[model samples]
Target: MSQVRPGARRVLGATAVESPVIQPRLRTIPEATVARLAVYLRVLAGFADGGRTTVSSGELASAAGVNPAGLRKDLSHLGSCGVRGVGYDVRALRERIARVLGAEQSRACVLVGLGNLGTALADYAGFGSRGFRFTGLFDAAPDRVGQRIGGLPVQPMTELEATVTGTGVSIGVIATPAEVAQQICDRLTAAGVRSILNFAPMTLTAPAGVDVRQVDLSVELQVLAFLGQQRAVPAGEVPA
Candidate 1:
């Protein structure tokens, strides 16, 4: 006589379900590596477009403004190693890096200001080539609202939520003045945007899991001026 197994008994004459397979979690890549991967991808794209099939680490690093060893180490995180005698396959490496960086997918982004800087960002063609599509443009000014930029209508602040939800936008850009940048950032975060590119001069605070990057042209200029001043100072001479 055959014996029935425990916990394997039939329920309503149906056999017991098998357990689902457990998959291993993916390793977390360093943020620096991620940034370099984007650089590498861009360089590889240029090579591929120019009909180049392979790239040595030294050549790629030089183009990417990074050291060869560091570039190789970063690529190694993605399990890519160049052949012993040959360099990396440009097309293959580009595809791999694109996958790693999620650049293979187009992400919808919304710009929240239509001022001079905002207008320039909206009109930029590079974002599209890099897989970021602008789905909405917004401005608080009445005169700016209803105007069109880069074929996208300048929407009012009132329509921000609707635009974000309707277009499934995940990234937000805040190019408004410092006074209103925080307000815009709050609205964007509440509307389900997780990544923000802030062009305003002030820093923004967001809850955990949200990413905010600030780009201040004035600050950059100030940094350059400081460097210039250092270079101009005579060696071993103290300035009053």
Candidate 2:
């Protein structure tokens, strides 16, 4: 008798028999839903911290700036069937969302470029509660090296690889100038950083399996300005 491959159907003469070890279907969550899940997590966290025990979907949706129906659909992806009248349990829902976003596990992060924006981001208080902790800081400037910010001393670029490797860091933050951003990104990727949050104004390329998220302040400001104009001036009308 021929051996049957796991998760595959095997032909036995005219009868097809499925292998005993069946492969489970991959439950792919939509990219948009993933983004919204972060928003929901943030809102749920706030609710939990505020001592709220239960929240209606409408309340959570309003707080998250999403429609109630859409919010329910997003929560459905988590396999949580919320009660019809009572809505969701605040702490329970928060924990569920956090697990899905991997927020329960502490992720060590390394940030390069200790300029103004970089320094401020390093000092941000919100990261700790969200399961992210910056274990290392790197800068190319000699003056920045050995300087301490947010309880971590800044290291020269030479220390990046060693520090990342030592800390088991998989996430990196780049706040360098546009010209040097790609160089720093390349170094981080080479050092085993798989996910990057880029604050530099330019785009940085990475090899397959690496994820890069860009934060362009000017673009966001311009978009907000455009929306503000739309409120002041009716559609299709230009301001004099």
lDDT of model 1, residue 130: 87
After superposing candidate 1 on the true structure, give the runs of residues whose Cα lies further than 4 Å from its correct spot: 1-26, 234-240
Tens-digit lDDT track of model 2 for 147-190? 99999999989989999999999899999999999999999999
Per-residue lDDT of model 1, residues 172-227, tens digit only:
99999899999999999999999998888888999898877767777666767877
Error of 1 at 136 (Å): 0.6
TM-score, cand. 2: 0.85
lDDT of 2 at 39: 84
Task: Provide the lDDT at 105 for model 2.
Answer: 98
| The candidate that achieves the highest TM-score relative to the unseen native structure | 1
What lDDT does candidate 1 reach at residue 180?
Answer: 93
